[model samples]
Target chain A: MKITDPRTAATGHRVSLAVSLWLSLSVLLALVLISIAVGKYRIGPGELVTALINRLQGGDGEVPTVIETVIFQIRLPRITAAVLVGAALAAAGATYQSLFRNPLASPDILGVSAGAGLGAAAGIFLSLPVAGIQLLAFAFGSFTVLLVYVISRAVRGHDPVLVLVLAGVVMGTLAGSCISLLKYLADPYDQLPAITFWLLGSLNAVNPADMQVSLLLVGLGLVPLYLLRWRMNLMSLGDEEARALGVNAGRLRLVFIMSATLVTASAVSISGVIGWVGLMIPHIARLLVGPDFARLLPTSMLLGAAYLLGVDDLARTIGEVEIPLGILTAFLGAPFFLWLLAHSRRGWQ
Target chain B: MSIDIAGLAFGYPGHPVGSDVSLSVAPGEVLCLLGPNGSGKTTLFKTTLGLLPPLKGRIAVDGETTERWSRRRTAQHLAYVPQQHDAYFPFTVMEVVLMGRGAYVAAFATPGRHDREVAERTLRELHLLHLRDQVYSQISSGERQLTLIARALTQQPRVLIMDEPTANLDFGNQVLVLNQILRLKQAGITIMMSTHDPGQAFYCADNVAMLRDGRLLCWGPTDEVLTSANLRSVYGVDVAVVEITKTGEHPGKVCVPVMSDPRGRADSEIQAPPA
Candidate 1:
């Protein structure tokens, strides 16, 4: 009866979450629209807003055809890609935390993003087109998770922790080596630039077609986990307890592994292996709200989208040359993760 | 609610830890499975709960074979509280308890209003209502044990199976867990547990199953099965079974040898010499 009371949290918790969610989403929304306005062509907020309005309503579209093309064709796709990628990364991170029952678990740290990058690089070195590169990335990303699961299964009985982490580092290093090999083998004229750009990770390459792929991949993969959210929450308690609760750990883990990597691979394929969004966003979500999975997963999705949008804007606007989204996210995310680590230390102790 | 194990065997691929272990449990009964380290108490619990498929034998809960049921369905019928869990993230007590409702909802759906009420009532029953908001891992070991039990209670199972549920707690906490279990038994819940503590076997258990060398040495009423002779044989040591004045009927004190010194193996009663 007490739990059914809508106000589970006191006034303070409700107020803080409401304020934070509103503030974060609003700031993120503003930055996205404004970033759409100020590109290499340098349109102001008014022109950007008018163009977006017209594009939605239909007509001369708003600005000149070229300007409209720049906004609609180029900048819009990139900004949308950033938000989707961010949301996917954060959602994947939260899923990983439940998968491994460790907050430190993330797509990159577990080597999935690395494997995806390696796959993309392989595609590039082989001179495959962009669509082919996306395929390669998803394939490699999925393979990495399977191998981790296999190795963890092999070394059963010992805590799944050490074996899993070891497998990630070993596989990640192997994937990194493959990336190095691709970089070395690439033709300097045509192939090298593509491989290099893929490694750096950018929204500069994303367009409507890529956005469509992003939507398809992330949408399908996310639905299962979202529907299975309560099961995932039960699972986070640890394997035996979950089994005791009547969950098939093997099946659930397989579903989560495949699905979480689906989102990661899509994000990786389109945006080229952005880091930290997954790892840090879950921690931040947990701190704001306690670790209730129902609350935590949805909140992580929203905040991750908003946070990545803001970060990508800064990436675009920092200087004459734009910083890679991956580098910018890492720059911001790693410290927040560390700060959380320090804060969690006292509470756990 | 009751359990029927025709024959149960468990172990790794090459190394079978237990075999031909037959047992049963009836409602309002506390059954304690006792064995030394590596004798297969934990393994038996896993097999019974269907976490690990038994290498041999059949386990039936409420007259139906375990293999017949879905994991969720089986989980709804029986609940287990494990030895000691150390999760890196300290989900709150309510959050932990709410996990017991895993079987009541559609896979992946949030626990509905009724599920939450069950969890709350379970926690309240365990005297953990005030502590529900506290992080589980941050709680004292005694409280953690109680919280885990509360979580199991929320499953609304007819039978409760636990593996050394009070292992990490101190003496006072041990009493609390045992007392709570007794109350659950009074409510007609069938109880099964594996514990190394002999005092617990006689003090609270209605039936005792002693395991040795992957075999069921005995399974019957507590007084008949957990004799000083049985303890000596299984553990390869001497034991002094002392009757407590508080409960004259049940043997409450069991003094076991430190390292199983075979030097003083008296024929009839193998026990601590003089002292």
Candidate 2:
């Protein structure tokens, strides 16, 4: 067998990484444009571009009012929400996987999604406003992870990662049961349907305000992760080895967990419990680019944004009634993930 | 740099693996720790590397007590090469070596050009530059061990603590790794290593410390400390320490295990010819 020189191979790898990054970014851009143009109203590409330009240049009334409303008010916000939620979930998944050193780890491994579901279900059962329900969901999601951290800390003398994961499983189960109870008690006439829809997840009701709030929270979470991205590579090497390499593994893990939870909670708050994107997108990204966290973060985010936006487009265009996002993601994500598993030459580990 | 361990008691919480361990390694010297499995050799190495806090002792590096030193400070002075194990990701060899610059790199920043230069230089010195782009998980175990040593060297550490550097390697690879240790010692870096093979200690170690059942059995110069009696006591088997005086080769000692049956009868014992 012949081996290539490292210098040449490294250069080649760098070129490939750059190409992959640009390719994914371009795909996401194309998807975003397609999503904006292909809604129920079916605005033509020329009209879509004209409407966007007119809106950007301060609305000169050249475009039709209905076109403007559909493009700006409905499709734009939904597209933005899908992108943000997908990126946040994927980033969180990559973070959790690296932190736990397990390929199976995802954003929901720490009970954030279950807690958010329970909170949203309660809010709907009590007939709370949309904003109030989202707020409660975010709070519950963050609090569940905090509780798990505390529980893991209180239990002394064990692998901290193992303990945290075990605690998360226990708490997640409890939260899931509570959500089930809430569902059972809800009036089947109205509240139960609302609860079910929220749990199944959708981008149907997202507005500009919800988009802005999620954008702010997800951006806040990503800044820290982006800045500390290189350290995450050390983190995957295990706590003792990372410590030996001069990283305060315990402190770094806390920061990463908190940032990931923050983004996941905020995304779940706006979009309900959209699953599988977090679990699947990072794996896809890992296959595209090798598992250096610094490179993995951006690649995962871009692919995630493109993937969810594409899936959301399918959900809206495939039928009269919009398909729930959670169902579609599982539908699309599972077989694709299995295919990836079967076809992948270099395993994630 | 010199490492001074005084009355060290080390282990996990609620589980004391070893206690009352005291030893020191002078600058540019190699100290070999010989012990059986479950005899707390790893625990001792972890404690010295500051991965585990000492339960009832003080570890000083160059006369400074290290109990309060941050992990970064400890890493700046001491580097540890853990046993070769499976990694969670397929990071390239260069990336793994670059991780050693973590002590010098700021918390928020990635490795800079200088760090890369250092990593490359270490890899080059170890004859590993050719494999720098290979996935770490795809490499052979011997190469993985060498890459780990290259990583430790990248730390620019004063003292290197290696836990069984030659463990799980074949004969040729073991000698290759031992030669690297000797080269590192010649470069004036203090080294402390643990091993299951007494022949390895005779090969490269300047001094030897034997531990059995959580206690230091003996500590002295390698020739005096690694005697047949000490090896027998530590491993519960009889062994002969023989000196080889082959032509055109440097003289050295090698330990040969004396075969015996379960009934305590010598089955194929070979008597050492009169030296």
Predictions: Cα RMSD each: 4.7, 2.1
Worst 10-residue lDDT window, candidate 2 chain A: A6-15
Candidate with top lDDT is 2
Tens digit of lDDT per residue, candidate 2, span B110-203? 9999999999999999999988888887788999999999999999999999999998999988999999999999999999999988988989
User: Top TM-score: which candidate number?
Assistant: 2
What ranges in model 2 sit over 4 Å off?
A: A1-15, A345-349, B262-266, B272-275
| Model 1 stretches with alpha carbons more than 4 Å out | A1-23, A38-41, A60-70, A109-111, A143-171, A346-349, B246-275
- In candidate 2, what are the lDDT values of residues A1-349, reduced to their tens digit? 9885544453243335687799999999999999988867888889988998998899889999999889888999999999999999999999999899988898999999999998999899989999999999999999999999999999989999999999999999999999999989999999999999999999999999988888999999999999999999999999999999999999999999999999999999999999999888888787678788998999999988999999999999999889999999999988977877777654463
Please provide, for model 1 over A60-166, each residue's C-alpha lDDT reduced to its tens digit, 9 standing for 90 to 100.
63467877888878888888888898889988999888677777788765678888989999888887888899889988987887787788789866766567768
List TM-scores of chain B, every candidate: 0.90, 0.96
